[model samples]
Target: MLNPVMNNTKWYELRLQMCALVPPPTWSTFSTAGYRSQPDREWFYHFREGGYEDILHVDIQVETPVEREIVRSALKAVHVPGEETPSGFRVFGYLHDGQGAGYI
Candidate 1:
């Protein structure tokens, strides 16, 4: 299970993709570059498939309008699972209105 020469993760290799309504404007021209530079690791949380399935809580607080829009526009809805919110996806490309599509 431990390959010293390759530390790549299962999720990163899969590179799941999702469609967003649109991206702000920095996703392609800027944020894309930043997101690619992460430590090449996967972040995950355990979910309870039983009683508290809908008990998840997320708090978002952004002070800047520009930054706020980027985070807000990331999610489509709670129905789509991974693509439910901005935190759900990664910067993939730009859309018709300079917005972006998020990939997992």
Candidate 2:
């Protein structure tokens, strides 16, 4: 009987290929109603109250699993104490490499 072995090369290659296929992250923006700006430049609002505004822009980068996990944990630790408004939260990913460089 022959045993089937999982080829991690194909998996890794596919992951790399898929990652390559995706366009690099770019700037984006969103607007919210009933949003309050703090002196520290943090905006507070609810997730459902406002729609994403095209005017507020940010650069978004594709995140790796470790990065995503770290961000998720960080978000969990953050505390926002104040009135919440809809459509408040801008998530952006950071890429260490693959920026301004030509792909093969």
Candidate 3:
């Protein structure tokens, strides 16, 4: 069960944080802020073991080159490693670059 008030407040906070992090001209819009269920067997096992198990996906879409670069840079600043290729997007754990531990 989700608490309406708490969820709404948290959602707004997240939206603001994202807007600040990406700013204008970099993130045209931020959408799909919601909760997701945990994977099947893992969820069941966690429930049985009285442990916490769940995951949330924060999805955003970027449109322009400037926006894409801003997002990629921001992720890198936070040590969130991402790959840039002529193909498409990719996400992975943060990897440090030579610059005193920055994302790669």
* Per-residue lDDT value at 31 in model 3: 16
Which residue pairs clash within candidate 2? 27-58, 28-57, 28-58, 29-56, 30-53, 31-53, 45-85, 46-85, 49-86, 50-86
- Off-target runs (Cα >4 Å) in candidate 1 are 1-56, 77-104
Tell me the lDDT of candidate 3. Answer: 0.34
Give the Cα error of residue 37 in candidate 1, in Å.
28
Write the residue-wise lDDT of candidate 2 on 1-104 in tens digits.
21212133422332233233333222133222223332221122221124333112222223465444433333334321111112222332121243221111
TM-score, model 3 to reference: 0.33
After superposition, which runs of candidate 3 have C-alpha atoms over 4 Å from their true positions?
Answer: 1-17, 22-53, 81-104
**TM-scores of all candidate predictions against the true structure:** 0.24, 0.24, 0.33
Strongest candidate by lDDT: 3
| Per-model root-mean-square deviation over C-alphas | 16.7, 18.9, 13.4
- Local accuracy of candidate 1 as per-residue lDDT tens digits, 2-91: 112111232222222112222222221112123222221222211111212122222222335664555544433221222223433332
Q: Candidate 3 on 1-104: residue-level lDDT in tens?
A: 32111133343343343455434222111112333334222211232232111212222345577766765665444443234534323322122243122223
Q: Which pairs of residues have clashing backbones in candidate 3?
A: none
